[model samples]
Target: MLKIKNLYVSINKNLIIKGLNLKIKKGEIHIIMGPNGSGKSTLSYIIAGKPKYKIEDGEILFNNKIINNLKPDKISKLGIFLSFQNPVEIDGLSMYNFIKSFIKKKNNNNILKNIYKKCEKLNINKKYLSRYFNLGFSGGEKKKNEILQMLILKPKLTILDEIDSGLDIDSLKNILNNIKQYINKKKKKRSLLIITHYTNIINYIKPNFVHIIYDGKIIKSGNKKLIKKIEKYGYNKFIN
Candidate 1:
């Protein structure tokens, strides 16, 4: 579903991700872990197609089409979703209108039922539908809101950036469980690219591939066993 080859990205001429290559075919979860400034978030933003971060070289192929030069909106239209590490609060935008507007723009004939189901799965109170989008929401509430978006959108590929950072245990469980539910019920591959530091998140979602990135490059790649090593020894052990 997603392939990023030899990606070299820079923001205002400062390089972030260098020589990064990764692939996500289908029915797979990939976790990207690295120390700060090691290009984890940079890779996420690069694949998300954010305009500011220029792709100096390489190509991002989504569903086999070159998307390196495409705008973020166009990327989303092609069924790619990025759940931000910190969801911004839009004071004037009601969640109801914001979600419905997005769905309408997708122009998919059938999405309403799944939308409400998503809200319910994320434990977002129906009343929250009337509230401003993320405005003054607690940290966990904000995380739940992101999951709510993920569930509703049901994009082909969901790139979650530190989604577990601010969420409490209960909220985290709900969000993770809902993701599994979405996969099982939909029977869609729905590739997940999770960028996180917490092994607890991985415990809930089994990743087919685990990649260790450091110093702006993929230092190592392995399977679920790598998660255990990280949990047992931490990134410090992997540095050497």
Candidate 2:
């Protein structure tokens, strides 16, 4: 569903991603792990078509079309959803208002019902529905809210950046299980790309592939066994 070939990216004339390559097929879940400054987040943003990052070389293809220069909104319209690492708070926009505006469905009642159902599954308080989006929400609550948006949109490719960071054990398990069920239900046309430093998520949703990204490039790629190697030896074993 997504392919990156020798992608070199830079911001403010400073190079970041260098010769990075990755491919994610439909129905597959890929995990990317790396230390700070490894360009993992940059790669995610690049795929989502975030502006200002110059694609110095190579290309990004989505569903057989080159998306290297498409705007973020256009990319999103092409069935890509990016769950931010730090979800921003909209000061005056109520969650209900935001959802109503963002979702393109014509049936308001059906949208509301689906939103409420997902909110209930994510343990989002009914009161939050009327409050400003993400305003004064705890880290976990914000994360859950991101998941809620994902559930409602049902994008073709979901890119979750560090979603497990602030989640507690129960929240993490619950959220991951929901994601697992979503992927299973739409396996033929859905795909997931997760950027995380934690391995606990593996217990809830097993990844089809694990990749170690370092210094702006994917250094190693393998199946679940790679997770064990990363757990035992750390990124040092994969570096250099």
* Backbone collisions counted per model: 0, 0
* lDDT agreement with native, every candidate: 0.85, 0.92
* TM per prediction: 0.93, 0.98
Task: State the lDDT of candidate 1 residue by residue for 12-130, as single tens digits.
Answer: 89888888899998878899988888999888888888888988888989989999988888999898889998888898999888888877555443455566677777887878878
Candidate 1: where are CA atoms >4 Å away?
Answer: 105-115
lDDT of 2 at 231: 91
TM-score of 1: 0.93
Q: Which residue pairs clash in candidate 2?
A: none
With candidate 1 superimposed using the best TM-score fit, by how many Å does residue 11's alpha carbon deviate from the native?
Answer: 1.0
Please give, for residues 1-240, the per-residue lDDT of candidate 2 as tens digits.
999999999999999999998999999999999999999999989999989799999999999999999999899989999999999999999999888887988798898888888988988888899999999999999999999989988899999999999889999988898888899997889999999999767888889999999989999999978988889999998895
